[model samples]
Target: MSDKNREGKRTARERMLAERAEDEARGRRRKKLIVGGVALAVIAAAVVTGVVVQDQRSKPETPAAAPAGTIGDKNLIVPVGSDNAPSVLTVYEDPRCPACGIFEREFSPTISQLEDAGKIFTNYHIVSFIDRAVPGKGSKYAANALGCAQDAGHFRDYHDVLYRNQPDETNDAFGDKAVLINLGRQVDGLVTPSFEACVNDLEFSGWVSAVQQDFDKSNFKSTPTVLLNGQPIYPKFNNEEITPANLVKWVDAANQGKQVGTPGTHGQSPAPTSTASEPNNPSPKAG
Candidate 1:
């Protein structure tokens, strides 16, 4: 009786061990299947990405044409005033710069007045240095769009609009070509096929790079860097108010002793010969 019971218990234990081994094998097989599935998915994704990249590389490249009115040695400067004006206001700016936006909003009108009066010429050195500092392509793309607008004879308009519609500091909406093209339509005569193509094709990307190269090589420290007759003007004048009146006063001060339009000279000066230049030197209002 004891042998029979012992044999039955031993057989039962053997069967339990065999069943556990089979279960363990099934678990290993399931795990291998899952790992293999994940590996296949990752490989498939890599293949798709490589194909897309290769396709893009295989396409013909269309370099953008140089826009009209590019000045300076590298042809990167966008001039927006009389070449013969008494003073030149050179500004190094990045489209993504918040400070640049503020300067444009506050002093652009005065710049327009001075430009219209033939009192001063405005030179805009657009750059994309922020692309290296920031995480997106907005700075480069927006500057490229401005280059296209320059060719359309609407640089100033488009430039102002870009600043006015500038996205939040964290946003990179300007990176989108469609957004850039849509902004161009607001300026009359800026919505043509060439302008659209220029914005979309990144035609001025090389030009943008050159401009940034010039900027990097310059002595300027930041965007909205303003220079009057090659003399650097501080961004914040008299307690952080860079108003139009302040701009006028600064220009007057810069030209204090020199004759109007004299380059690099200092001191008070008379007005230009043109009657349109009469209001160019408006006295800064008493604060």
Candidate 2:
């Protein structure tokens, strides 16, 4: 081969080698960039996860403050009447529940009579599930107010007042602290600074939630779930319609051989200065 041709070939071969080296270098740089990006993304994700976990850990859990004179499981019950009564009446209710209002209006007088006579002890489980289904804080607020009333030693009296003044199912009037505080005025010696603060601050909110949780875990589906000695008896019992007469009859039957219970200092319904008006026709389903 000629000298000029050999020189040209050598130069071209050198250029080709240089280009191949450059391409490999570029590939290595790209691989490094890809690996670095992946590492950064993984670190960022881990940091975010850690922050979320830390935030969750830092948040304090709400404390449950049950009312005075509470009894039964988890201190979730507000007892009325006499604990020594032969028959125990378990009542699960919600303040915002229209059916519960009806139950209270219709049966409260009879129940009070029975309590005064020391025939049955009533255990009230106040829940706030209505706030979940309906659009309002009335259930929670009213329940908290009820707790405040209980703390003031006027649960039964204030309970009757609430039902009498109960707003419509959709109305959230009870959500207003002012409304609750004003209602407290109806009960003799209930509207104190502490009672107002308790209602406004939602003092017993955790306790209401606990009661709601218990209701959710139970087999009961709706409010005003009245059980006589652990037996369902609100709407019916033994295939017969439930009435005040039936209730007394059932209690008498249950206490046929047993001695009548004397009224206890706790859980007794005192005579209210005012009377509760009649409840509107409520839905059959008390939810």
Q: What lDDT, from 0 to 1, does candidate 2 have?
A: 0.75
Record all residue pairs in model 2 with backbone atoms less than 3 Å apart, i.e. clashing: 81-267
Q: Which residue pairs in model 1 clash with each other?
A: 64-203, 86-261, 255-267, 256-267, 256-268, 257-266, 257-267, 257-268
Candidate 1, residues 146-237, lDDT tens digits: the string is 98888777888889889889986447899999999998778877889888888898888888877776655554545667766655565455
Question: Poorest 10 consecutive residues of model 1 by lDDT?
Answer: 50-59
Question: Whole-model Cα lDDT per candidate?
Answer: 0.69, 0.75
Error of 2 at 179 (Å): 0.8
lDDT tens digits by residue: candidate 2, 1-287: 99999999999999999999999999999999999999999876543322111111112223367787776556667878766677878788888877788888888898888887888877788877776655789988998888888888888889999999999877889989899899888888888889988988899988887777666656666667878777778688888888888988998898788877677544434322222111112223322
Which window of 10 residues has the lowest lDDT sum in candidate 2?
50-59
TM-score of each: 0.66, 0.71
